[model samples]
Target chain A: MTAALETFDLCKTFGALKVVDRVSLRLPQGARHALIGPNGAGKTTLVQLLSGVLRADSGRILLAGADITTSSQQRRVKQGLVRTFQVTNLFRGLSVLENVFLAVSERQGASRQMFAAAGRRRDLIERAEAIIEQLGLAGDRHRRISEIAYGQQRLVEIAVALSLDPKVLLLDEPAAGIPSRETSLLLDAVERLPPDIAILMIEHDMHVVRRFAREVSVLVGGRILMTGLPHEVMSSQEVHSVYLGQAGQKRFTAGVPHV
Target chain B: MTARSELLERHSYNPIEALYWLLLIGTFFAFPNYLSIATTVVIMALFALSLDLVLGFAGIVTLGHAAYFGIGAYTAALLASGGWREPIIDAVLAGLASAGLALMIGPALLLLDGLPLIMVTMAVSAILFEAANKASWLTGGDDGLRDFSFLPVFGLFPWSVYGQTSYLYALGWLALLFVLVRRVVSSPFGVALQGIRENRARMRLIGSPVIGHLVRAYTLSAFMAGIAGAVHAQTNKFVSLEVLGIDTSVDVVVMLVLGGIGRLYGALIGAPIYILVKHFAAEWNPYHWMFIIGALLIVAVRFGYGGLLGILGRIEAWFARARGTRKP
Candidate 1:
């Protein structure tokens, strides 16, 4: 019911480059916040910092008012802070259902029982199946991930994250490489996610972003240019200039006007 | 189920499984006549399986796994000589002690990956071997420790004789450890380690602590190797610095690779094949046997993706196609 995630005065440096330069933002519970930026705008680096995969040079990341700047990735995940990669990351040889079941097994604290068959973990399997069904992945559940289509692979990656039972989900380009038709499947999955789960996604497709995001934070040259509701941020001249460059004297409504 | 429908099922036995049963049955039928060598094969198979847990499943490459194997052997030897003759207690403690050494070294070894892991593990094995060699008072130096009785497993009476009892004892221990390790690899932890090998970064983002899992796996693998070592010591009634040496570790890796990496029963198939080849080579030409092994190893790596099983699998596929049958 409050700010589920907060980053204050965040900074990260690699050699002389300040990848995330004094970035500050608060993601309130249930807010669908979109993080859009040009390539190498430090968006992935920021995600890494927030998820404890990379430590911030100088900043604070508080989840539900508790500082988790130095927590391990596993601990951060256990605290309901989860993130997905821009590239599809899944157990390539395992069946799609098994990958999600592994996540659910970990969540249920039953993965370590040595003697019992992993398949016999009924509760874990049921939960995994339900999540797969919710993500529209049930048809492909029994298939090996490598055998699945690329779009389905991306969906499986998100489904793996969803099975973690996260409170705050950070998705790095969830729609990348997915076709327009399949992109809606991703959006539908995101939209159907429980409202209590706060989502922060990085996306290049502005149309997809505008369809789903309530708020958007625009990053330019490793700094936030402006953050506002989708329509307001789209209408801003600074955003337009930065997005389209100086050649176009006219403004585009997201992708349309630029075209 | 109809014959064609049942034959179409995808859950056919991996060729390795067929090899395992063949070897097990073959050994059971053939070994009592030549108990000494058969016993040795069983011991080697146990060691190979332990190595498989790390090399095949966890993707942890080690050329020094023999360090734990030797430690277990030495522990069991020392404890048996010190008037503590309970076989179960000796084995459990020896396994713990061996795994303890692994736990001590696994963290440092876990810091390295790929070729560096091999280098560090070999270095560690060398260090342990030198220490055992120099610690003459405890280890009996290069003379090797002997003249100890292994306690009966579950008070079995026929196991009072050295040769017969030891062979059965080792056979039973190998079976138990095999079942246990097999259970673990199929468990959730096993699947997670497989995930780690495929994409560790992805596994981490999904809440698996990659390094922690690796360490745990290494420790468990070490424990299995230790148990194998303890069995080796009891059956042979001798423990020496050579048990802790790099050659033994290399043998473990070779056995795993020869069988096929990643498959559990690969070790069972690979170890016996390794021992048979070695035994035959020793009689044929002890001097050039290592060259033969080295050449075969290179062939396995270059052509056999899943080792001997892979070759057999391809042949099976070809045969199935010729018969107008489906792929397994």
Candidate 2:
């Protein structure tokens, strides 16, 4: 079967630095993939190139067998390839429900209606409410984003992404900065997404990587160092020496004793 | 479930809105002698409303909105003097002309943001202003366009010297545009504009055509402002370079900021207060009236981020607390 999202020989350079150098990745439909690396491993840069936030200097990106390397960010989203930012980017002045409703309405093609009141769109509001409830944000749906806690804001960001009904979802550190207790809610929310939607998550937490991602890709120096089943990728010494080094390898072993 | 239902309830008709409309209509009888100034207020309010649509809702900063206004004024003046005496048709043509100009420039102009965007808009207005000035043969130069008479409203109510018909004519347009704009700002399209305003990058991620939406909004806003300009030309039977002046553009922004930026009613609230203050203060000293207006703007900005509406909202919230009622 054709991969849902595939990048072949993708290369991006920032003057003297080659941030993402000839990296190739394939995410099949419904695949649960994790991308992990230490700081400056170009994980975020790779995601940016795929989402069209940044143009790749060289290489091709194929979405469901269609070459979309030159598509604009909005066009990429319409093509079912969507991503969340590393930092929470939301409509801060609007209510949480308004934020999600805007996404849902766009999906429904109702966002172009200028005369009908948004509140009167029961279908859009109902779908938005269902998404909010699914994400455990129903209680705070009516509150403006500025009134919510940072962790709740993070969940709202995911909720906005899910509202797009993406075929290939690129999550950039969804659990970053979220408290451990709140992280469970986020993970549960992610777990509940429709199975046919492919997910590629970039996470730094070993525990989350083990719990969520079935397959793993270890990236170092702007290239994928290894890709295998989670157990094999985590246990590979090449990934350790290049990514975790000595001290990080010891911490990884100590923290995840079973792996 | 109750909370979810309450979300929809917020959009329901409030009794206060009825009272507000009644009060606006009541002003016609309450101050008959001030009808001329009142007509000016109505025109400025429409202009401010147009600015609010783009600046407040879409977060597209512009300092040269007068380009559309002047274009509309000149279009209407030329048509009326050139023997096209149908008042309503002239206004519609004027609006369309302004919208056409906006459609051409909005795509390129809206691509810029912040200081650059402001500068470009100012440049557009400056170019138009200079063009109108040098094209003396067509526009009557500094002497201004004269010798034009608007046909009576529906060929019935004549243009009275007492300004009653003019006030009612401008008020009718204001009322129509106000309802249309209010409906727009409460729609999904309006919400999306707010999304664009608040976070444009995220708006794009959600598949919203950000620049396209902004261009449409700018075009619609120019259409409304064009009507206001046409009304001014029709009522005065004149058009001049001052119609496209930077002061008119800057003044509308001040009016929008003074009343409130994003709120729809801010235009109505800001226009009358500014116009009335200018009317009275200029009477005392025409040269120094700007100082009072400037001082009022500083107070509005320093104290209330939402302008007067924000201040009133705070007061209402305080009252609700004092009465032991939960704040809405």
Candidate 3:
């Protein structure tokens, strides 16, 4: 399979801290991948570098085999390399459909329409409504972003990203602020994503990782400690170090009934 | 789809919008003695409306919008002195000149945000103000630009001493620009602007050319402000360095804030309230006019949550609820 998104020895540093040190990854087209790490493992930093939110000090980023090492965030989004924020970063003042419509209309190049009412664009509304329905957010279509629940706000984030019609969707903690009760809905929506789009979900929720990911990587201290099948990566001793072992809980790894 | 359109239409300008204009028009007959002050209110409304595009909607913190206003004023005065006396044509040219100025400096100014943005905007206006002061030959320096008159509007109606033609002339421009600005604020581009104001970073993530959009808004805002300035020059029959002064810049923001920031209707309500009070209060007690204005601002700021329109909205909502309907 061809790699849809790949990074080569990507590096970023802040002051003396090497935040994302020599991270390299590849997500083949339609790959269901997860990047798991302990706190401060640079998972978010790596996503930022890939999405062009932050510049990598060294190495390159590629999307469908073309180098996009230093493209602007907007350019990267236009080129089918879109990302969602770890925190819900939506227009809080806008309604649910308006948030999604902005993305759909931007894709349709109707944002420059200076005279016509934006809501009157049926093509944009239909696409936005369809994506909202896909995410099971149809009931909340009339609500403003601030009026929606936190978990639903997270769903709106994904809906907006989907409206961009990306080839590679980078979800930075899609389930971060979502309640456990609602995460199942998020997972169901994730499962319903178009099969052709490559997804790299950066998650701390191992349940989601186990439930959705076919393959997983463990990251610690700004480096990937291991990458393999979900079960293999989770059962490995290195993953134990990345998760429970770091807080002087190495013994906890062995004390577990089953990894 | 129709439901969404209806929802959007309801969310737009209030139904009571027609009343404000009707009252403004009624002023020509009802308050003929005060038409001059009423006309000033109309001009300032347009100016404040232009500021709303950048400062109110796009959330660009600016301190030098008067640079455009001054440019428009000077453009009209210069054109008039140069024997190009068509007022409407001169105003259009003034608008283009101001927009051209925005094109020159908007890129650099848009790069900086927050405090630096405010400082640079102030500096731009100060620079323009000084240039006018020093260039006596062209701009008349401290003496102000004078010695020019406007041709009869459309070669049909000449300007009158009782400020009759100027009142109607200014009102016509205000209505036309208001409709244009309303359309702009309702369009996709307008929604994008509000998005930029609310969450600029998110806008970039959504694939918007943030700086490019800001530049366009800034330029268009400058164009509108220039038109107001040109109208001011044509109606008042004079131009001064004050048109580009920092006080002029600050006054527009004050007008917007006192009226309601980000509401085009707020500019209309706020400008008239301000100028009318300034006119009548100064006539009553010129020495204590500042105190009167200060007290009005204090009461408005402390008690008026959304300014007058916001209060009007609350009243409308109250009435709607009283009638057991969501809207009236």
Candidate 4:
């Protein structure tokens, strides 16, 4: 079967630096994958290219077996490719419900309605409420994003992305700054997403990577160094020498990985 | 239970709605001698509302919204002078003319954001202002357009010298546009525009056509502003280069900021406050009225971040807390 998302020979250059250099990756339908790298490994840049935020110098991106390398961000989203930012990008002034309602409305194809009040739209509100409940953010629904804690804001970001009903969701470090206790909620929220929706998460926490992603891709120097099961990728010597330095390599592979 | 409460919350009558009606009805009794200024206030409110649509809601930072306003004024003046004197039709034609200009320029102009967007819009209005000023034959140059007679409202109420009919005419237009704007901002499209305003990149990733939505909102705003300009021309039976001036553009922005930026009612509140202050202060000392206005703006910005409406919102929240009610 064709992979849900595939990037072939994708290359992006910022002057002399190859942020993403000829990187090819694929995720089958319903595949749970994680992309991990040390700082400046071009993981975020790769996500940007996939989501159409940045144009690739050379490559083809296939979504459900169709080439969409030159599609606009909105077009890419319409094709079932959605993404979240590493930094919580949300409508800061708007209420959390309003933020999710916008995403739900977009998915329902009702976002263009210029007459009906969005709040009074039963379908939109119901869907938004359901998504909020699913993400365990129902209590904070009415609060402005600015008022919510950073951890809750991260969940809100995930909730917004999930509202789009994406076929391929690219989460760029959804739990980066979230506390360990709150990270469980984030993990649970991710776990509860519809199984058919393929997920590619970029995470730094080894526990999150192991618990969530069945397969992990270790990226170094703007290229995928290895792709395998979480533990295998984690224990690999290449990832250790390149990503984690000698001290990190010893601590990481000490048979007890610290989350 | 939650769903029912949500519906009730959505359908509940906001106190501001009552305030709007009260203000609308109180004008006749409150300002009997100054109906002309009142009418000007209503027109200015509509102009500010138009700017709020793009600037407040969509976050399209424009410094030259007067281009559409002037175009509408000129279109109405030209049509009336040419003997097409149907008031409603003329206003609509003026609105369409403005919308048409926006449609033409919005796609290209809206591609820019922040400072560049402001500069481009300023340049556009500047170009139009210069064109109107230089095209003496067509636009009457500095002498202004005159000799146009507005047909009576439905040919029943004549344009009275006491400004009764004119006041009512402008108020009717204001009421109509106010309802239309209220309906629009509550709509899904309006929410999406707000989304774009708050986070444009995320909006795009959610499949919202950001630029397209901005263009539409800009066109709609220009349409309303055009109507305001047409009303000005029709009431005064005149159109001048000043209609397209930068001052006109800046005045509306000040009015919007003074009242509130994002809230629709901000325009209504800001316009009257700004205009009335200008009217009285200018009479007292034309050169120094700006100082009072400037001071008021600084206070509003420094203390009340959301403008008048924001201050009222805070007061309401405080009252709710006092009453042991949860803040909505």
Predicted structure with the largest lDDT when compared to the true one: 2
Give the lowest summed-lDDT range of ten residues in model 3 chain A: A248-257
Predicted candidate 4 versus true structure: per-residue lDDT over A1-259, tens digit per residue: 9999999989999999998988999999999999988888999899989998899999899999999999988898888898888898898877888889889998999978888877678888899999999999998788888988999999998889888889999999988887889988889989999999999998877777877998889888899899998888877777878755535555355533566
**TM-score of each candidate's B chain against the true B chain:** 0.89, 0.94, 0.93, 0.93
Q: List the candidate numbers ranked by TM-score, top first.
A: 2, 3, 4, 1
Better structure of 2 and 3 per DockQ: 2
Taking the tens digit of each residue's C-alpha lDDT, what string does model 1 give over B1-328?
Answer: 1122111122233564555556655665676667777778788888898888888888888899998899899999999999887787897789999899888877777977999988888898898899888999999989989988766677674444436666666777788888787777766777677778877777776777678888888998889888888888877778878899888998888988888887766787788788889889988998989887888788887888888767776788779778875534
Worst 10 residues of 1 chain B by lDDT: B1-10
Q: Write the per-residue lDDT of candidate 2 for residues B1-328, one digit (tens) a residue.
A: 1244332343466677777667667878998887888888999999999999999989999999999999999999999989998888999899999999999998998889889999999999999999999999988989989999888999999999988888899989988998888777778888888888898878888999888889999999999999999998988788999999999999999999999998888998899889989989999998999999999999999999889998998898779678886544
lDDT tens digits, residue span A59-139, model 1: 899998889999998889999998888888788877888788878877887656655656555677789899999999987
Q: What tens-digit string does per-residue lDDT give for candidate 3 at A103-211?
A: 8878888878878987566778889999999999998887888988999998999999999999999988998877888999999999999999999999877778888
lDDT over C-alpha atoms for residue B145 of model 3:
88
Off by over 4 Å in 1: A13-22, A39-41, A57-59, A246-259, B1-31, B151-162, B318-328
Comparing 3 with 4 on lDDT, the higher-scoring candidate is: 4
Could you give the DockQ of candidate 1?
0.41
| Clash pairs, model 1 backbone | none
User: Each predicted complex: what DockQ?
Assistant: 0.41, 0.59, 0.53, 0.50
Report the candidate with higher TM-score, 2 versus 4.
2
Off by over 4 Å in 4: A13-22, A234-246, A254-259, B1-16, B29-31, B323-328
Per residue, candidate 4 scores C-alpha lDDT tens digits across B197-230 of: 8889778778888888899999999999999999
The DockQ for candidate 2, computed on C-alphas, is 0.59
Residue B304 Cα positional deviation in candidate 2, in Å, after optimal superposition: 1.6
TM-score of chain B of 3: 0.93
